[model samples]
Target chain A: MEKIVLKNVCKIFGDHPQKALKLLKEGKDKDEIQAKTGSVVGVNQASFEVKEGEIVVVMGLSGSGKSTLVRCINRLFEPTSGEIFVDGQDVTKLSREELRQFRQQKFGMVFQNFALFPHRTVIHNVEFGLEIQKSDLSVRREKAEKALELVGLKGWGEKFPSELSGGMQQRVGLARALAMDPDILLMDEAFSALDPLIRRDMQDELIEMQQSMRKTIVFISHDLDEALKLGDRIVLMKDGAVVQIGTPEDILMNPSNEYVAKFVEEVDITKVLTAETIMKKSQDVAYLTSDGPRAAMRKMKNNAIASLFVLDKQNKLHGVVFADEVAKLIEKGEKSLESAIHRDAAAVSPDTPASELFAVMQSISHPVAVVDENNKLKGIIVKGLLMAAIAERGGNI
Target chain B: MSFELPRLPLGDGIEAVLDFLVHNLAFATKAFSAVADQGIRLMETAMMAVHPIIMIFILTALVFYLTRQRGVTIFTFLGMGLIWNLGLWSATVSTLSLVLVATLIAISIGIPIGIFCALNGYAYKIVRPILDFMQTLPAFVYLIPAIPFFGLGRVAAIFATVIFSMPPAIRFTTLGIKQVPKELVECADAFGADRWQKLFKIQLPLAKTTIMGGVNQTIMLALSMVVIAAMIGARGLGGEVWRAIQRLQPGAGFEAGIGIVIVAIILDRVLQKLSKS
Candidate 1:
């Protein structure tokens, strides 16, 4: 089931009478509201769903409505017109008490500013949601302790929010959210306020936690690299509207628009894509056996091969040896098969995109090959395959 | 250096000044009584409007207890008793009663007005000048108009005191409410806090220090008007001082002035402590 859903949500602010008149006059479009009252449309007919256990990163620059969109999901700001459902429950229609219960039971929010209650201690801050939920004191405390331990702040319960560094404070905020055992976590630039070094550390910690807990998270950030690293799927927003929504791999390989293309162009795609895209396919009829220097040379000449894949007796790929490498080995009078071969080679699976393989090959200055699940050589995907893909798409190199 | 006439003896000079003050007091009293009689009913009405002193005492005690400060508790007790012991106890109580009544009235009137002004810039523009005028005008200036309407005694005294004391309370309350962090307000709203909840819980609690500051200023200004109000037969330490001066007794006048100073200090300290608490 979808964990959260927002249908046609929009938020506008101004005088009530004027707003009502404008709404009536301007009809349903956000432009009409803006034209009438000069009010900002914070979220403009936003519609999306977060599936269970999926990490959806909402990415936008400042004032792009990404923050506003996430806030609207929890009804932090009432959407001007729309409906929101959390776990199939219509949350937008909830009363105050019901909303509080919804927040306590289903939603956990972390703010960019940390928003740790200044008057509360670390453990007390973490336990704030539970306290608001009116859980038993001992049970809340116990839960808070576990949350603190989970966030790696186990021994710092007594310290006030001011006593901790920025990153530590954010961890306390994370622990606070975690203490509620929320179904969905909303993180609004939770790591952006920290120093770069600390941000990296927190990101690693978040990834580790996500691997274990598998909670649905809607993370908001402007940093492209952060989005690339943490997002299972990313929704890029601009001016209160979604520009693109796709997996990080999809975004990196094929950005939806020029804006997205420009955004992706600035990122180093080589480090992002794995070694599974460029591995070669093996020939079914032919197999590599113990062949002498002349035999190997004759095999290379006859096949018009630039490089040959090295495989074990079990047909598992060991590596590859270029023609020059074999020739060098022969020139050096190396007789052993092992001594004649170069085992270190770049290989990727069939699922890896041509764009990623191209990037990896460009970085390494070599042709890469495709491989299968059992580490057997599949087929070679050289610089030509990438060139052909890009050429076919009529895209710039 | 310039040449000058010989100075009078210190004792003789003192006696002469004392004589002048007494002459002025005797004349002022006759005028004060004439004003007092015109509104005797109003004075009684004003007295009837006085707040229960028990409430003030309880509040002071509660604040002191909460703070758990020995110095503050002692000051609260001493302040309450000193106002009673100064022979102007009944008059002081009457003035206090009127001031408290006026202040309560001011709060009811001021808070909403302040909130309105804060929310609407146009309203702020309209109210700002009136606040300025109310704050700047001399305390006695209010007496001229108040006397014509409420007449003399506690009623006029309260009218004048409220007029003088209210501006600070309203101005500061507006400022306090306006100055609440926007993000915190947003957070509260996001958590589904409606207008009323936001005002009472988030805005008011956060604005506590500034609002209390306004309260402190109002109480001090009200206390300051006690002496001026006494000239119109709003009896208090001011009347005691007026009588001592009329009888040409420097010792009596000095003691009464000292008593007024003590009351001022005690009230100031108590309010200051309350604000902190």
Candidate 2:
């Protein structure tokens, strides 16, 4: 389901926006229109869609209009011309009052500078949106408390925004947005002001929250690495226009133009390619509860592998059974593959970075098992496949 | 030969307008002035009833409570004691009441107008020139119409002082609100805050220090106009200085002038501390 769709949106900032917009429609570029009409084109006929439960990062340099574009989604910056549809409703057609009400119910926003009200306590800042919506005092307070807890500031509610560090202030910002429980989150360079380490933690925190919450998010950023880390699909914008839109691998592997290629060229692929992206499908595995030692041995033989991953009825990774152990168990007439299963096999969550795989794989002789949160086997990463995945991505493997 | 431009009738035109306003508006103005006169007298009597020693202690306590600064508290205590010792305690109280009432009126009107100007560009454009004219006009100019409207009393003096001191509060308020960070305004808007919500919740709170600075300036401006107000029968410390000057008693003039200075400094320090808090 599409949550937000912007069509031919153009934002001309000046006294004569309509005149500049007319020139824009006549195929005049931003500079020509600016020189001719003295109107700067903030966003020039940019179009994009954000799907429900997907995070789409709008990445660009300083003047690329990413911020303007995101603001246009909620009509914070009214588009000079074009349609903005959110959940099938035309947002541009809304009256001022209607837009205010619509924003209260549909969207949440976080800003780069944290934009927390210095006069407000942390909990009060978080409660602002709910209070605007006229929610009950008790209800909003409970929601605000829950939001603060969600952002890991459980006991810092009474502190003013200035009392917190930059990272914690941003957490308050995120909590402020989350308190509204809006369907879509528009984050404008939300973590750009933080130190690199804190920024990374915030990115991980957002991703972790998104795993269960699954709210549609449109994140604006200038840093390529941040976009790659957080965006499910990346939108590369330039000079007030969207140049390319694709998944991280699609963008890194096949940039639409030289500008995008250069933008992503400096990024280290090993840090981005996670186990989920690089791991191959496991060819053979034996059920620990149902399969006998002979079945494990036969499966390993058929796949021409020395060992086979063992799983129970729930498809959880029980362990790995080496062919030698299986053969010994078969010679001893052991019926269950559990006797042959080796529980010490190395495993990694699917989201672990490929760079970390190198460290984990160095000490393990067998293939690393890629598992989900429930320890269910998702894929396998043999050493050769990991190397090939890196080399294929143009890494210095 | 030098050609002279025809002398504009600007002064005559203003005089005519003032004449018309005086004729048509004096009834309402006089009624308001009576009420204001009664209020000032009431306040003056209430404040004067307190013993000078008691008043000094009360004021020092207030300063200490507000500022929590040992230096300022001591200065306030000594300053009030010196003014009392100079036999100008009653005169100082009158000046304090006049300045306080005028400042309160200026702030009450100025801040809202400032907020309106900040939010509406058209209002600001229209008001900006008027504010500049009010600020640049000689302070005594307000006394002319004030005399006819309020009839030569503390009310008339307060009228002129309010007009003279109001510009800073209005100008500062508009500037402070306008200077609130663009990103913060955007954040407020993004959260769907209404006009009132945005003003009270974000803009006003952030602009507090600047607004307070403006109020402080208004009070100081009001104080500066005291001697001029004395020319219109608004007697206080200004009256004592006026009498001394007329009699050529330089010692008495200095004593009264120093008394005004002490009062101004104490008020300024207390207001400065309040603004910071």
Candidate 3:
């Protein structure tokens, strides 16, 4: 089920009503108004659904409105106009008291600066949300203690925020949010203020928490690499609008626009795309010996094999022996498979897309073999599969 | 040959003002009589309500103990003894009681006003200039108008001292409260603290130091008015000093001044320690 959804969300700022009206009247598009007045349309007609237990990351640069977008989701800053539904309830129209109640029960936000009360001890700070909700003192204390324990700050609960290091203070902030037992956690650059090493640790910690709690999270960050590392689904935003929303593989291989492509260009595709993407479907055809020229040709003619995976009895790929190579083997009257087979064959898994596969193929001077787990032959993706994928995409096949 | 000293305009104005003050001695006498009657009543009430001598002894002992200096203790004891020796012990106690009462009242009124001013820009705009005027005006200036309204005695002294001392307390309290960090306020807000909760838990705790500075200033200002208060019929070491000065008894006047200094020192030290604590 979708946990949160935004429909036609638009956030425009300025005192003048006619400013937006005048822009519209003058046929000056959103870009013009955005540039002219520096009155940002923070989230422009943004529409998306985040499924339950999904980690959705909103990724952008500093002025891309990622922070504004996240804040608008919680109505920390009210949207200019939009419908926001969290767990199927339209929360935009909620009264102040209703909104407070909703926030108390449903949402937990961790800010970039941690925002822990300096005067309060860690325990008191963590218990603040519960206290505001008017929980009994003992119950609030117990819950706060448990939350501190959850955040690995059990013994340090009595220390004030100033007494703790930056990372520890951020842990207290997290504990405060967790004490509310919120359904959704909104992290607005939660680890952005930390040092790079600490940020990596915090990212790991968040992932661990998400693994156990299964809380739906919407994390905002300007760091693309952080988004790639933490996000189950990334929404790349530019100029207050979503440029692309997809899995890491989808974004890495099939970026929605030039902007998104530029963002993904420097990423190492081999690390991002898995073997499942480009691997061909398993076929029932027999494997061929490199020297068995007549038999390979016969098999190729009968099965219409573009190329056959050369494997020993263990089903491990030795190399790919193409039909043309088999024809050459036949001409040379080769008997041994080793002599006829090309040992240096480019290979990809089913998960690899055409872009990566083509790149790999271009670099290697051999037909690309498709293989599955345990290095077992699936099917050969010679120039043909790449051509088909490229053709299907209406490009240079 | 004769040398003539030139009479400056300012000096002439001063002499004229002094002559006018001397001519108004009758009104001063009337005001003093009224203050003396009130002082007697207050002392009788204090004696009946709480043993004044015992309270004085305990306060002196506490001051001496905290100060840990024998000179201060001896001076305090001798100052009280001198007031008793001058036959003004009861009147001095009455004046001390009135000052304390006035200070307490001022704190109660001023702190809230200060906090209000600090919180609201409009209130600060309105009250700031008034506080500036209150602070800048001479302490004796407060007595001139106060005499006609309250008719002298403990009420007039209290009215004057309260007006003189309140500005510092209010201003400092407001400044202290205002100086609470913005991050702290935001933290409280994020934690869902309501207005009252935020003020009590966050702002007040953080502003404790600054507010105490204000309180200290208020106490010191009140002490400074102790001698000036005698002109309005405040009976204390101030009355003794006034009597000694009138009789041209330098020894008595010096002793009375010493007594006033001792009391001021003890009170100031105790309040300073309290502020630190």
Q: Which lDDT tens digits does candidate 3 get at residues A129-233? A: 888888999999999999999989999988889999889889988999899889899898999999999888888898898888999999998887788878999
What candidate 1 gets wrong by more than 4 Å, as runs, is A15-37, A277-397, B1-174, B189-205, B232-236, B245-255, B262-277
Give me the candidate number with maximum lDDT.
2
Measured against the true two-chain complex, the DockQ scores of the candidates, in the order shown, are: 0.17, 0.84, 0.29
Q: Write the per-residue lDDT of candidate 1 for residues A262-327, one digit (tens) a residue.
A: 888777554454444433344321235676555566677887866666676776777666677678
lDDT of 3 by residue, B130-169 (tens): 9989988778888876676557666677768878888988
Q: Top model by TM-score, which number?
A: 2
Per-model lDDT: 0.74, 0.91, 0.76
Give the deviation of candidate 3 from the true structure as CA RMSD. 10.0
Q: What is the overall TM-score of model 1 with all chains considered together?
A: 0.66
Candidate 1 per-residue lDDT, tens place, B1-277, comes to 9999888699688567756654666555455445444344454455445453653466468647666677766775666565555454555555555556666656667777887787679999999999988878777777766655555666667667767888878888889989987765665544334567568756787688888888888878877776777777667677777787789988878766776776676667767777886
* Candidate with more favorable, higher DockQ: 1 or 3: 3
Give per-residue CA lDDT, model 2, range A296-352, as digits (tens): 778888889898888889989988888887888888998887766678889999989
